[model samples]
Target: MRADPNLYDYWPYRDRPKIVWPGGKKLAFWIAPNIEFYEFDPPKNPSRPGWPKPSPDVVGYSQRDWGNRVGHWRLMELMDRFGLRGSISLSTALIDHHPEIIEACVARDWEFFSHGIYNTRYSYGMDEAQERAIIEDSIRSIQTATGQRIRGYLAPALTHTERTFDLLAEYDFWYTCDLFQDDQPQPLKTKGGRLVSMPYSLEVNDVITYGALAMDPWRYADVLKRHFDQLLEEGERSGTVMCIPLHAYLVSQPHRIRAFEDALAHIAGHAADVWFATAAEIAQVYREQYWDQTVADIEARGLASGGTGFGPAED
Candidate 1:
C-alpha cells in the first residue's frame, strides 16, 4: 500500500489566481447524471463481491433497471425543460444494453464520459493490461455510440486501482470525478498528460442525499438551494464549481422527481451569475486559463505534494 498516492499539492482556497468562467459567470454549475448499467449477476473480483446479497440480486439489479426503463426519461425531460444538458458519467456498456437512452442524450447534445463498463464490474485487482483494456474499450465504445471521444473518467462504482490516475493521464483524459478533494478544478500530478480533478460534489449528490443521508424530497431541494447559495456567494471572490451528481433511480422516482425540478428552478431561474456548463467545457477553460498559474502558485507555496487516500483504495 502507498503511504501517499501523491495525486496533487495542498491548494488553499483563500487566495490564489482568479478564474473567470465564460460570460463572466461567478460559478460553473454542471449536472452529472450517472447513466449506468448494472448486471443482475456479474463476474466477481477477487477483492470484492459484485453483489451485496446472494447471486442474482434481483431486487438490487431491478431498481437500477428502473433507472433506465422509467427514471431516466423522467429525469431527461425535466432537465430539458430547464435547457440543461447532462454531463453524463456513463457505464459505457449501456450503449449496448440501452441504446435508446444513449440516443436520447446524444440528441440533447449531452456530454458523455467514461464510468467504466458497468457499475457492477469493478476495477479492483486488475493488472496493467486489464485496466488499459477497459479504458480502450470505453473510448472505442463511446466514440462508436455517440461520436464523442470521452474526456473524463469516474471509476465504476468508484472502484479504482493504484494506477488509475496514471492510466487516465496516458489515455489523455481531461478530467476525473473520482477525487473529492476540492470544489474547483485542480491539476493532478499524473505520470503522463495534463489532467484536472473537476469537482463532482458528493455532498449534494442525490445518491448521498437520498441513499446515504435518507433525506426526504423537500429537504433535498432545500439542501441544493442552500448549497448553491453559498458557492455562488463564494464564487464572487474567484470562480467556484458546483456539481449535483445524480442517480436517476434515486432522484427521478415519482415522489422525488419534483424535488429535483424545484432545485433546478431555483438555480436556473433565480441565478444570473452561474455558467450552465458541461464538465468537459469547464475542463477546457480551466486548462487554458488557469492551469499554468495554478501550478506556479502551488510550487511557489511549496504545497505540491500530498497523500490522496489514508488507506489503500477499495473503490
Candidate 2:
C-alpha cells in the first residue's frame, strides 16, 4: 500500500526570504547529471526479492558495452563543450568500479550527489538502521573516491522511505534533491532541522523523455528549450530557479547528446541575466537568502497555500 500522499507536502517548511544576490535579475539554473552503472546480475526467477527488475529485452539492450562507453564519453564531451558544472547523481558502486571517472570528476570540480550503491538496490524496505548504514556507506565510498564529501542525495528510482530525511540529516548532508516540489528551491522539515529540498525536474528528465518516451534529439531539445524559456519568463516576473535532470545513460547517447548541446547553446545565446549554478550553490542561496520566515513576508506564499493544488499538499 502507498503511504498517505500528504506526507510529501513541503511548503509549510520554508523559511522567510532575504535579499542576498544584490541584483534582482539573478536566475539560478541547475543541471543534474545522474550516473547509474551496475553489474548486470540477471535474476534467476521472476519472483526474486528486491525492486522490480526490467524485462530481459530492456536490460539486455540497455547494457550494451558500446552504449555505456558512448554514454560516458558523451557526458565528458558535453561538460567540456558547454563549460557546464553539474551535480552528478552517482551510484557508489559504479564509482568504485570506475576510479578513473572519479579522478576526472575531481579534476573538473563537479559535485557528486549520492544515488545509492547501485541502481537496482531499492531502499524502501530497509529498517532505519539499515538505511542509515546504506546512506553512510555511500557517503564514505563516494568521498573516498572523489576526495569530496557528498552533501546531496537522489534516491534510486526515486524510491525512498519516511526515514530518508532524518537519515540524510543525521549524516550531515546539506540538502536532498529527491523532491518534485516545484521549479524552485525550498526547505524540507526534518527531525534535526529544516533540510533544503532542491527541486528536480521529472518532466525534462532524459531518462523518461529519451529512454521511455522515445523522443528524438530534436524533440527533446525543443521540450528542454520550452521549459527553459518558460522558467526565464517566470524568473523575470518572480525570482524562481530552474532545475533540469539529465541521465548520463540516456542523454549521453550520440543522437540525444546533440539535442542537449543545442538546448545549452540556445540558453547561452539567449542568456543575459541567467545564473547557471550548481546544486550546491542553489542550496546555499536558498539556505542563506530565500527561506521564508513568516507567512506575511514569504515571497511565494501561494505555494504554501496550495496554489497549484496538484500535489498532495492540496489535500
Candidate 3:
C-alpha cells in the first residue's frame, strides 16, 4: 500500500510560489451551497452505512427534505442579499425532483457542480463501471437541466473511489472539491488531463458548525470572519482561496440565517480586495496562470513524478 495517495506533492506553505489573482486581488472567495437530495430508505452498503439510524429514518430524511422544501429558500435569499452567487454542489436527481430550485439558481446565473446522483448514494464499494455511470449521469443531467456542462465535482457525501481522480480527468472535469489539503489551488497528478483541487472547507461548513461542534449561531458567524481574516492576511504575500461550504438544512434555520448573513456581510464589506468567484472560474484561472509552474516545481523537488514518488526523504 502507498503511504501517501500521491494525489499531490508535499509542497511547503512557506514562500514556494507567488500567485496574484486577476485585478490584483489577493483572495478568491467562493461559496458552495450543497443543495442535495436524500432518500428516506436507500439501499444499504455493507462497507459504509448510509445513515446512522434504521431504515426510513424520518428524522434524518425529513431534515434534508426540509432543506429542499423550505430551508433552501431562506439560504438563497440570504445569499442574494449579500450579492453572493452560489456555486451549488448539486445532487443531480434534484433536477428532476425539484426543478423549481434549479430554475431559481439558473435565473441568478449561479454555477452547478456535481455532488453525484443523490446524497444517499455513496461511492464506496462501487465498481469502476458503477462509479463511471454516476459521473456520466451527473454530467448529462446537469447539462441538460441547466444548459451548463458541469466542470467540477464534490463526490456524493464525500465518498471517493481509488480511481476517482483519474476518471474525473478522463471525463474532462476541471476540478474536484474532495481534497482539503491546501489553502491555495494545487495541481493534481492525473494521468493525462489537467485537474485542479479546489478549496472546499469543512471547518466552517454549516453542518460542522452546527452538528459536530454544537456551536451557537453567533459563534458560527465569528468563526467564519476569523477564518477569512487570517486567509486575507496571508493572501497579501500571494493569492489564497477561501471557501465556505454550506448545507441549507443547518444554516437556514430562523435563528441561524441572520448569523450566516453577518459573516457574509463582513466578507462582502471587503469588496475591493476579494474576487467572488465560482469553482469553475477559479479552476480556469489557476490552470491558466499557475498549473504548469506548480507541476514543474513539484517534480523538481522530487515530490511527484518519476523519482521516488512521495516517501521518506533521503539526504
Candidate 4:
C-alpha cells in the first residue's frame, strides 16, 4: 500500500538539529500518569472492539476503575515524594464521573491534556466531522474543568484517523504524543498550521512492560534504568527526551510500586544531568527556540522530499 502523503517528513536521527534543554541538561525527562475512566459497557467501534471479551465486562471495568479509586492516590503520593510533577494524559469525561481525581491532580498544578472523553472510547472509524466533534468535546470539557487550554493530545486507546494531526493543528493543539517517530521533539507537516510531536514511550510504558511483555516489577525497573542510562549517555551529544508513560492500575499495584519507585529514585539521583520537566514545558521551549530552526535544518538536509528512497545499498 502506498503511504499517505499528509502525515510527516522523513528526517532521520543520525544528524539533525541538536536540542539544548533548559538548565543546560542533556536529557529532558517527563512523567505521564494516564488518569483514565474506562466505561463499564461502552459502545464498540466497527474498526475495533472496546473490551477484550464482551460488553458488561465487569472484571475488566472494575479492575481499571481501581486505578482511579485507590491506585492513583498511591501513585500521586509517590510522585510527590520524589518531587516529580505529572503531565496528565486525561480522559475528559472524568470531570463529570470522577471530579475528585481531577481536583487532586489540579491541586498539584499538574499539566492536563486530552486522551479523549474516556479510555473506553476509540477514535477509529470516525469521519472527519465526528473526529472534530470529539476534539472539540475534549477541549471544552477540559477547559471547563481545569480552566486551562489543552496543548497536547494522546488519542483515546491510541486510535486515530488520517485527519487527526491536521485537525489537532487546526484546533491549536501544540503537540501530540501519538507519533513515536523519534527520541526528540520533531516538527509535523500539517496542512497549514504548526504542530510538533513529542516523544511518548511505548517501550518503557508500564502497561506495555507488564501487560504485553509480561515482565515482572523488578524487570520493568531494570528496563527503566538501562533505558535512562543509555539515553543519558547519547543525550550528552544531542538532547533526547525520555518519557515514562504510566497507568495507575499497573504501576501503582502494591507489588509493583516499590520497584518503580526505585527506578525513579535512580534517575532523580542524576538531577544535574537531566531536565525533569512537564511535556508542555518541553514543547513550549522547542516551539519558541528550536522549532523553526529545526524545520529549516531538516529542509536544508534535503530530508523533507518525502520520497520512498532508502538511500544507497550497504557497502
Better of 2 and 3 by TM-score: 3
Candidate 4, residues 17-95, lDDT tens digits: the string is: 6778898999999999999988888887787778898988888888788988999999999999989999999998989
List the candidates' TM-scores in order: 0.95, 0.83, 0.95, 0.95
Per-residue lDDT tens digits for candidate 2, residues 1-67, read 3344332344442343433332555457778877776546633322233324554445544654343
The lDDT values for all models are 0.90, 0.69, 0.89, 0.88
Residue 134 Cα positional deviation in candidate 1, in Å, after optimal superposition: 0.6
Q: Which parts of model 3 have CA positions greater than 4 angstroms off? A: 305-315
Candidate 3, residue 92: CA error in Å?
A: 0.7
Choose 3 or 4, whichever is better by TM-score.
Answer: 3
Give the lDDT of residue 168 in candidate 4.
93
Candidates sorted on lDDT, descending: 1, 3, 4, 2
Mark the regions of model 1 whose C-alpha exceeds 4 Å error after superposition.
306-315
lDDT string, candidate 3, 1-315, tens digits: 556777777898886678888889899999999999998788888777778898778899888999889998988888888888989999999999999999999999999999999998999989999999999999999999999989999999899877888899899999999999999999887775889999999898888889989999999999999999999999899899999999988999888888888899999999888999988999999999899888777778776643222333335
- Which candidate, 1 or 4, has the higher TM-score? 1
Residue range with the least summed lDDT across 10 consecutive positions in model 1: 306-315
Kindly provide the TM-score of model 4 when superposed on the true structure, using C-alpha atoms: 0.95
Residue 155 deviation, candidate 1, in Å?
0.4
- Say what the RMSD of model 3 is: 2.3
